[model samples]
Target: MKKLSSKIWSLIILFLVITVVFMSLFTNFLYDQLYVKDSEESMIEVGERLQSNYQGGKVTDEFVEKVEDFNMYSTFNVFAVRNPKELSACVPFEIDYDTLIGPEERRQLLKGEPITKIGYEERFEREVISVIVPLTDQNRLEGIIYLYYPLARITELANNEVIILISSVVVFSMLLAFFVHKGLGHIMRPLNELQHAVEKMSDGDYKTRVNVSSKDEIGKLSEAFNEMAAAIQSEDEDKKTFLATVSHELRTPISYVKGYSEAIQNNFIEGKEKDDAIQLIHREANRMERLTNELLQLAHSNRDQEKIDVYPMVISETIRESVDLLKNQSKHKEVEINLELDDSLIVQANEEKLKQIFINVIENSIRYSNKKSLIYILLKASGGNAVIEINDQGIGIPKDDLPYITEPFYRVNKARSRADGGSGLGLSIVKDLVKQHNGKLLIDSELGKGTYVTITIPLMEEL
Candidate 1:
């Protein structure tokens, strides 16, 4: 909501105005002083001529003629003073000399000291500027020369200079404002795009992106924005696929249950056929129940992160138990599970979750694995940890799909997975269950070369 551009522009203008105004004032003051000094120096030259040419430091007719000539040729009101208080040799005085020159100035000149001063005279109703030069012969005061230069001339010139300076300041300020506005706009353009992108994302448009090329902060922000959008887009896609997979899985089982139940009720089949149909109906119901149970497990995991009842348990026994439990299923698939276990392999884990982890992994191997394939189940204590490695000669997952093989509802071969009665949550559940026991789960697979899954857990003592 706060305008950063306006704030920056205001500071820039404030600096410019302060600098320009100070320069203008100081320049005008300097110009006025130098102008007055030049005028005084010119009068000083004329005053010296008059004093040197005078006899006994007094102005003669020739001197008077020269003064008239100097006045005519030069720009000054020239006069000669006999004493401090009176004008002796002269021009027709428009302003009384006694009233025009101050007593302090008159005394200093009459005592043979030359003084130049600038003042305003309300008595003469005009501003006055004058240079007074003392006439001295052998250091004795004889007469003084007064040179009057019009102060109006300096004011007029200063006014003209000020007008020009103000005009230039105005022009420069205009240019500065224009460029600053443009520069700020360019800098903020990326940020504006980012804002729009965020708004689009908020509105559930995950495809939003900001196009930026510069390698500055704004560009980095744009890149981050795009990355976020991509992540959200990917999750959204995964969710849709999951929904479709789940819908198909649920619908198939329900269709069988509904069809078989209706058939049994309507006597559509004879005795043996009816029994087979009921068995199929039970099988479909069990499949649906298993799917729902896995879903509930996922939901329970999300809801109860700290619900695990962890304890020190022997992993070898747990593995043996899980293998025994799946013995019939493995026999049906003609899969040979080879067990290599270390009895000392004990770990801190939730017993139920550990059993579940092993069950899911072994079931997956049995389902995907080719008939009569060897499934290696190995457990050992190594480097202060209990390690479980399961390598299965299943129709192995694709090399590219190894990374996402543990994601919920992610199947390497969708059709094959579905045919195997896989809701695609088996590996995902196993992964979560192992993690709940503070274990690391690693999977490596190659197409047609089987898959290896390793679980590493810190070994707990017999306490």
Candidate 2:
């Protein structure tokens, strides 16, 4: 179970959204404040103009005409002059002026104090700001001049500002999201490759690698991963060499013991016969002990490595050596070993492991081949790989067992394998060694015909 790394752009996008939201709110607040101040100033100026034009005279049609002209130029609606005993109104039509002006503000205007107030006027069903000014003639209080101005225009402007601010914020957010997604992808691309490499390693693909050239943290991580894989690969190669050496050493002693044991049992010498038999037995016991130890070492070498070593070697040499090693087993059976090889057939591989691969193939052939049967070794270079095929005229393996031949400890005929002294590890070892060389091992067999094992290794030049 693995988890994907968190993306950096997600955090950046969140921060951008918060900042944009805060800035939009602040801008709207400032705009509303400025608009309110301008509206108030316009209302005050209109009220002063009316008071200046008509303050010295009594109410007349001429003064009403002046108020109407001022109303056309300004936002003022309700204009009235209220004296101590009577009220002279120039509202252009009949209306309740008292209701439009709140009582407290009206009282302040009548007391010679100019007042401005904002309230909803019921007659118009709208909100308005009113400005009131006092008029005086010859040192006596003549009347109060009141002006009403609707706040709808300011409200509409503020609404438009909010719409524009919201639209800007949305646009900015979308652009930020796009850029953030792209930047995060750029940063995480190497990490994604590293992750895939790790998965391949888990599945025993040790040669998996990541190529990321950068001076950043992700690049550093890729470098570290490659170093670790190389170290593991080196250790693995050392282990394989150690196992091959040990296996080779044990084989000589095993052959000697088997040879002497048969010689003594057949009485090649007459005197001290029992002693010779005991000595032969001792040698055989010791040989088996050494062989078992080598097998264990080979098994330990098969553990997972972070990387693998791949090189080129002659396939013909490997097959020839394997056939010569097993030639003794073919003595009584009259098995004919043949080679069909390309002169320059070379493959990328571990040489010793490649030798072991053919040893396993030929040994299996010797064990199962019918008396006087032929075992053919064929080699070809094709499609960037050197293909080595071992064909044996033997008691062919069962179809069901063919698929599991490469699995450790699996055998088609367990009783036969035991009788043949096989530990059921040959094909498994062959498969592992071939994979380490970045190659494939294929087995094809029919019940009555014969079995063919094909080892396909990458060509040296291709590597």
Candidate 3:
């Protein structure tokens, strides 16, 4: 349940903590390697040089005097003691006799091995580095020379550098945290707005949108969100319009059939009048049936296009068949359909759906054409498609209405009425079928110049 910001900040803090610890350990290692090791080597050299000056004789006051003179010019505190117990006199405080030179150390000293000690020395009251070189004569310990330097003095330079390093790390961590917090806020701002807009849409506010201010990923996300919102709003409006249009289209026919049936039931008229009323009822019933069937076809066309099975088919033959089926309807108005076809043209499409597309467009051309006018049907291969262009010398659509002619229940002129114009769902059904077959449908027209519908279906690849 934690917020994204909290998780990101946690990771940043963890990284900084690890970096600070690594830097501290690295500085300590450098101090030991460069300063402490060199200081220990220097002390050992001084101690051995003094031990060599002993001359291999019994302990004497002259030898002790020579060591005392060497101490004045050296950085280390140097001391010479006759017995091991006398080594405590080098410092101002008392140290344990056994801790300084135990029985094990005495044995090693007699054997001529020097002992090096480095650690905290309570008597000196500081950490110290020291070396002990033995003076021997005739295989017996005569005396010893002691040398020591305070560990703090030897590592002073590295200690200063470590303090500065720790101080800089602390300051840099604080600054980085401040900037990263602000940067995260800047990055998350657009995402937050997008989330809020999505919430509004889920709550039925399809008009909600977010601002796009950059060309980055977040900005692209905002643009996509806006497009989705616009599409949803358009669909909602279309649904409302469709329902209202359906109600209006059915009301008049229902009223006519109802009024006439009631009069007939009461025997208000007989003979020819009753027969005429019955015929009118039959005609209205047919209109209602046709409207219902077209609506069902339109609904079916909106389904997933992947469900439509398609294959290579002769598109020119389907176009010719559609023309033959509609010949009687065109003949009623004395309209002639002239065909110019490329019989070899083939396309990848569903046969039934492709036939329906041609029927709708050609019928519309026939319905709007003047008496005795000629309708042109041309089929040829263009680019990689089988192109079919149906042109008519009919009353064409206005420029303003051309764009929306394919919308369900849209008519260029409402005054022409449903009875004369047929159902306004024809072109919409045509558009949907064309899309299902992965085809393009383009309509170009001017008022009184007739409409030109161009349909292009992809040709079979092998052909």
Candidate 4:
């Protein structure tokens, strides 16, 4: 349930904290291994060097005086003593002889072996590192040489460096967090806007949009979101327009049928007038039937694109067949359809749908053509496509209406009687069928000149 930015910031802070802790631990390890160990070894060497000065003789004042004089100038506390109790006067705390030279340590000291000690010494009130070397003469315990240094002085060498390193790391971490926070803010701004826009869209505001500020992935995502919003808004508007137009088209016919049926049932008209009323009702019923059928076909074409079965066939065959089927109607209109086709031009398409495309376009041309005019149909191969052009020498469509000619129920001449012009869904059906065939449909027309329809479908590859 946590937000993305919060999770990211948490991870960043965790990483920095872990990094600083690990570095601090590693620095302490290095200080112990490199500095403290080296100081211990140096103390042992100094004690051994002082032990070599003892010759085969009894303990003497001259040797002790020489050790005290060396200790005055050196960092180590050098001691040459005959007994452990004599060294007790060097510090304030009372010293126990057994604790200073334990049984095991006494044995090693008598054997002329060096002993190193490190830890807290109550006598010194701090941690101390000391090395003891026995001054043995002729295998007899004579005296002992001692060299000790405060452990704090050895550690003090690197404390300042370590402190500075940790301080710098803390400061750097703060700065990194600051910049990362700002960067995340910049990056998530577009995403936040997109989230709000999506919420608005879910609540029926399809027109909501987000701004695109950069060419990065986030910017591209914003652009895609805006495009999707625009498409949804357009689809919503189209649905509303479609519903309103459908209601208007059906209302008139329903009113006529209702009024006429009621009049007849009530015996308001008789004889020829009754027959005429029945005929008018029949005509309205037929118009309504045609509109419903066209609407169903349009919906099927949109949904059935993936279901259409396609095969290779000669493009000219479908055109010629469509022209032949429409011959009787063209004859009634006094319009002639002429064909100029390349018989070898083949395309991959559904045969029935291709024929439907041709029939719809050809019938449309015939319906709009001037009497006794010629409709030219041409088929040819161009750019690996089978291109078909249907041009009519009819009352052409206005330039402004050309763009919307393929919209269902759209008519170039809105005031024209539906019975004379036929339903305006023919070209819309043609367009969908052409698209189902993976073809492009282009219509160009000039008012009073003519309308030209071009359809291009991919040609089948020769095996």
Candidate 5:
């Protein structure tokens, strides 16, 4: 089954409702106009028949009998009045004379003015169309005749007209709806194709393109979608090429460092000069090891479903261990690393990875701090998480370099970084490890003041 879009469905429903309502109103208006004219003409004929009876001087008992009999079969009420006082004298019908006609209406009839009124009457509980005419003999007003016709027949005729009009309208409306729907489908065929093409493109089938020949908005949209798919395909190819080149370039140095370090360690050289060379080789090996580890971590982090092992570990203990490992490196500077933590504070994390996280952050602090400057470590639970902050007063990173500080191999000052024996992968590893624990790593630094690295991890369930 095909599903219609909300926009199209709404338009269809709106169009159908409007067409129905408009046709109903138009049909009612046309029928009312036709029935009004017809009823008025019928009323005139009834008035003429009453006038002819009066002019023949048929104003006797037999004539009154005929009028009384006429009221039983016909829908008109006939009355013959000589004057306002003798209104009941000439009329034989048992009529409610006063209730039916007012004094002003009688006066107008006597003065040779014919009266025609069409209105609703409360007494009859229905509408009446009355025609009153003067009966004259020898240029004198003999009497006035009233012809009252009930509007029931006109109402019936109007009802029939409405029924017929509605039936015709329904039939026509159905036909119109069918044709309109078909026309709309024809117009939207290209849009439907364009939509299918876009779906294919979204599913990575960039070769799909819409063949919209019309010079309209939909056509322009088709052209733009094709162009976008082409551009995305080109970008995807370029990214693959760049990643391949970067992988090849990074692996070559790592291979050399590993090979030479292994050769030196295996006694491939000897003597004091060889010892120095071996030490340099070992340093290069460690540097390469750091680089390779960062690359692997980066690849793992980029995966959508990388497995992470989380557990409880003491925050203060991790910091103390990391500082002790780098204590010899900071001996010449007399750098003092201090911890401000609660003894029982713990965090949920991967234990080994969290240790590496602490090592990278603390080592970066030692490398950048001024000689003899103190590195402060603070650990506490704040806002439902265990927060560890490392603050160092050093030549802080530049403002622009701060954003890229955690990118692998990115250095704020390359010369200074190399002097500190950093491969520029420390902070990047810190960031990845923090993320693996479902934590946040924040860096705040001033140009000359110092830099602060804050790592926050969710507190363990045991508290």
Candidate 6:
């Protein structure tokens, strides 16, 4: 395969070479016609000048000498005609005026048409451009004036000019090719770096960066690529951290469950001791179950959202149910409950998933709320949405943690969470469930104040 630079250069050079050849041929064709036309016009001018010199269709020897001198100074092959019968020459040429100037031209000249033509003479081995006029004496047609220009000189002049034009084109093309090559190199520099970056990323090295130097499209692309790499690196680091946390979380409980079960099976305890062992195994198993459930929820959230069954359901009733379920738990925390709901807060949602969303959020609030502090559950139809907010007066989530509070396995206070048996998937689950119902989740909090997790689900049209 050809290298990119080689391919580009070859294509450019090919186009330029073709252009050069085309221009040469085209200029060749056009220059001849242009030269012939110009020659005819010059000849007309000379013929008019000679008309002033002629006297009654008769030219003196001096006038003839002057005509010959005029021919020598200029670039014309000259001849004179005294009517149709008499002809004279100022220079040597094979074809006479009678044969060279056609009767058709003669008729046209008699009728006041300009005599001009382009012809080739076999004897002279050259093409000719000619112009003839009626010699006038006091406005009376006396004789004829004929002037011819040989094309050999015009061809020489055209050849010289064509060479100059082609030379200039070659120089310009070379410069253009140089500038284009430099420009492409500048553009491709970023792409080349990007290739390496992508390759490194594929090899699991995500810390790749590209240098951006221009404000052009290629530079913008480089910027975007860098951003993508940074995001991937962050996600990869987060994944590793998550795995380590899960490993520690899983191993501790599994070891407890295994050790306790084995101890009981071996009859290592009796009476209260045996009961305690069984309870310990049961608690460890429950911990494992919670962890497993969280993992499963995280894994299947996207698929569950895809298969969500949306129907109009009263959000206020769902909130009441969730509040009731958490009633005993909040009471243990000595947390007072306050509910404000609009009964008409109906939203398009999957009932089971909606219930689960409410359960997770309320449970999170219950776990975090300060003892004897108020937990506010508000549900109202606001702007065509069922707006549900769970506010807890507790150790609020830090401001810095608010953005990532809903990410799976993200915990603001890991120690407190572990002590409370919190799986860290509650808000994450709430977020995904809300999304399944085409809803938005927003968590607002300031450290030491309180946290408010608001869910907005599209309200069903009350028909």
Pull out the clashing pairs in model 5. none
- Lowest lDDT block of 10, candidate 2: 84-93
Error of 6 at 139 (Å): 26
Global CA lDDT of candidate 2, please?
0.72
> For this target, which candidate reaches the highest lDDT against the unseen true structure?
3
Better of 1 and 4 by TM-score: 4
TM-score of 6: 0.70
lDDT of 3 by residue, 1-463 (tens): 8878888989987987898799779878877897788888888888888888888877788888888788789988888888767766666556566877888988889899988887786766677877889999888888888777777743455477788996897799788878988999998898888889999999999989899989998899899999999999999988888999998888878888999999999999899999999998888888788788889999988866557999888888898899999989998989999999999987888889899999999999999998999999999888888889999999999999999999888898898846684779999999999999888999999799889999989899982
Error of 5 at 223 (Å): 14
C-alpha TM-score for every candidate: 0.66, 0.48, 0.82, 0.84, 0.48, 0.70
Native-to-model Cα distance after best TM-score fit, residue 39 in candidate 2, in Å: 9.3
User: In model 3, how large is the Cα lDDT of residue 418?
Assistant: 68
CA lDDT, every prediction? Answer: 0.80, 0.72, 0.86, 0.86, 0.72, 0.78
lDDT of 3 at 324: 94
RMSD of every candidate to native, in Å, equals: 6.3, 14.5, 3.8, 3.6, 13.7, 5.8
Per-prediction backbone clash count: 0, 1, 0, 0, 0, 1
Name the better of 1 and 3 by TM-score.
Answer: 3
| Candidate 4, 195-217: lDDT as tens digits | 89999999999979898999999
Distance (Å) between predicted and true CA of 178, model 4? 6.3
**Model 1's TM-score against the true structure:** 0.66
lDDT of the structure predicted as candidate 3: 0.86
Question: 5 or 6, which is superior by TM-score?
Answer: 6
Candidate 6 lDDT tens digits, 1-463: 6668788889887997898799778877777667666667778887888766766646566665676677677777666655545544343445466665577866666664567767776756887777777765555555666677667653466577788986898899788878998988976788888888889889988988999987888799989998999999898998898898789888877898888888889888789988988888888889889889878887788567678768877778877887888888988999888998999667778777788888888788777778889988888777888888889888888778888888877888877777688877778888887887788999898777788888898988767
Q: Please give, for residues 1-463, the per-residue lDDT of candidate 1 as tens digits.
A: 6677777878887997899799879977876678767777777777777766677756465665666566777778877655645553353335556655577865665666678767766544556677778776765666667787656554466577788987998899788878878999999888778888899899999989889689988888888889989999998998888788789889988998998899899889888999999988888888888899998998787667667888888889999999999999999999999999999777888888889999988888888788889999999878888989999997787778888988888878876765677888888888777777778899988678788889898899644
RMSD of 5: 13.7
